[model samples]
Target: MTDTTHNEYTLTCRFSSFDTTVDVIFNNTVDTINDCQKKNYEGFISKQDYLVPEILQQVFEYYKKSYPDYYQGWSYGNQLTKQQIEENLPTPTNAMNLKKFIEPLSVYIADNKNCEEGTFGIYFDCTWDIKSSLGVVIKKWKVAEVGTGDIAFLF
Candidate 1:
C-alpha cells in the first residue's frame, strides 16, 4: 500500500495505529531477500503494527530463555569477557526490571513483495542493561501473524 522509497541502512516509519515513529534499518546485501521478499515487508508491518507491546515483551522473554548465558553476565560491573574486560565497558543486567532502559529505536523492514513475505524488526537500545541492542524481528516479536525467532531473521 505504501510504496515509499528507502535507501540502504536506516529508515523512519510511522505506525498510525499507535502514533509511533521509529527508525528502520535494512541490509540489502542479504542473499535471502529479493525484490519480492522486500515488498512483502509492508504487509508484515501492517499485520504486526498493533502488537508492538506484546512483541516487546516477547523479545525480553526470548532473550532470557534463548541466551541465558549471555544474559547472565553482569549486574553491577564490567563483564569478564575479553572484549568487555579490555574495553572496560561496564556490563549491564537483564532489562526485566529496567524496563525504562528499554528504548525502542527503530523499525526495520525490507523492500516489499508478493510471493515470499518478509517481516520487520523492532530495534531497541537495551544497552542500558545489556551487551548489544535488543532487536525483535517479527520473529523475536513472535506473533504468529508476523513470525517467531531471533533478530537474525530480519535481514
Candidate 2:
C-alpha cells in the first residue's frame, strides 16, 4: 500500500461585504513528506500534517481579506457577461495576475507550489446552479504560479 494521507483545511474569506468559503486539501506523497522535513519546517511532516492546515487557514484568510478586489472579481467566476466584464472591469484570473495577487502573502510552501502541482483549491457556492445534482455550484481556483514558475489558466 502506498503511504499517503489527506489533509484538508477550510478557509473563509470576506470580500465586497460577502463571504466565501474555500476548501484546501493536501494529498502528500512520501517524497513530499521527506522534503518538508529536510527543510526544517515544523509539524508532523506527514501527508496530512496538522500544522499545515492551521497555518494555511490563517494565511488564506488573510489572502482573501487583503485582496478583496481579487476575490470579488473571481466570485463571479466565468459567469460574467461581456458587458459586465467590460463595464465593471472585473479582473480575470490568470497566472501573471495571480502571482501579483498572492505575492503579498507569506506562505513558504505556496511560494514553491503551483496550481498545476503544489496546491489544490475548491471554491463552494461559486455558481447559481444550486440544484445541479453535483451539490451546490462548484467552482475551482488553482494557485497557477508559485515562485518563478510560469502561470497557467486560472480556475
Candidate 3:
C-alpha cells in the first residue's frame, strides 16, 4: 500500500538483491509518486541495485588508497594506513555483498542540487565502513576526494 501527502510517498518496493521488500520514501519536485515517476523510480532502483557489490568493493579500495590522511585526528590516532586497511579488509575474487551495511532511507528526485531533472538520489546509512553513502544512482560514481566520510553518487 502506498499513499502520498504532499510529494512524499512511502512505496513498498522490491529492489533486486534485497531479500525483503523495503518501504522506501519517494520525494520529488517533478511529479508525484503516484504517476509514471513511481515506475521510473522502481526501474531505476532495480537497475542500479546491482552496484551494491561493486560499491562495497570500491569503499575498501578507496579507504586503502587514501588511508591515514582522511582518517586523521582520530581518538585512535591517524596510525591506520592504507596497507593496514588492505591487510584487514577482504578482497574476494568476487565482489562481496555488503548491502547489509546500508539501510535504505529515501529517494530524492528533481530535488537534488547536484544535477538536473531525471536526476535522483537514494540516501543510505553506510557510515564510513562502506557505511556512509548519499545514495546509489547510475550517474557518476566518485567517492569523496576530500574525505567527507561518505560517497555521494548521483544519477
Candidate 4:
C-alpha cells in the first residue's frame, strides 16, 4: 500500500473593500497522506482565523433580520453605526461552521445602506495538515461579496 502519512494545505482570502476585490490563495500537497492532511486541516483551521468578513456577513444578515426599513433598497454608499455592527456578531453555530479556529485577528466590514451598490467585504487567512485515516480530503472555501447593483456571487 502507498503510504499517505503527511499532507499540508493552506488557504488565504484577502478582500479589498476600497477597491471591491476578493483574492484567494490555496496551497496543498496532492496524492500523499501528509500533504492531504496538512492542506485539509490548514484550510479548516484558517476559517476560524479571520473574523472581519464573517462578522460583516452576520451583521448584514442581522440588519436584514431586525431593522429592515433602514437598509431596504439602499446602496453601497450607506453608512452604519458601530453599535449596530457589533450587535450583528454571528451566533455560536454560525461562527463555528464558518471558521474552524477562533482567534482575535478576524475583521468584518459593512456598508450601512441596503442597496445593490452597498458592499460587504471579508478577509481570511488559515493553515492545516491532514490525518492518517482520512481519505479523499476535500476543502472548500467560499466568500460572498455583496454590493449595490451587483448580484451576489459565491467564489
Worst 10 residues of 2 by lDDT: 132-141
Model 2 agreement with the true structure over 1-155: per-residue lDDT tens digits:
13345331212222211222222222333333344322322221222233333333433443334345544554555786655543323244332322222211112222124323234322222121122101111112222322111111122
State each model's CA lDDT, in order. 0.49, 0.28, 0.46, 0.29
Model 4 TM-score is 0.20
Candidate 4 lDDT over 1-155, as tens digits, reads 12134222222333332222332212123233333333433443455335345554553443335334333323236485545433332222443343332212222221112112112222332111111110111113433432221122111
lDDT of 3 by residue, 30-88 (tens): 33444445544655565555555655566445545644543442215556765664443
TM-score of 1: 0.49
TM-score leaderboard ranking: 3, 1, 2, 4
In model 3, the worst 10-residue window by lDDT is: 142-151
List TM-score per model, in order. Answer: 0.49, 0.22, 0.49, 0.20
Report how far off residue 128 is in candidate 4 (Å).
32
Number of the predicted model whose lDDT against the real structure is largest: 1
Where does model 2 exceed 4 Å of error? 1-48, 75-155
* Whole-model alpha-carbon lDDT for candidate 3: 0.46
Candidate 1 residue 114 C-alpha distance from true site, Å: 10
Candidate 1: tens digits of C-alpha lDDT, residues 8-100: 445466755445676555544333445644454555466655565666556556555544354345423654665653232223344344355
Q: Candidate 2's C-alpha lDDT?
A: 0.28
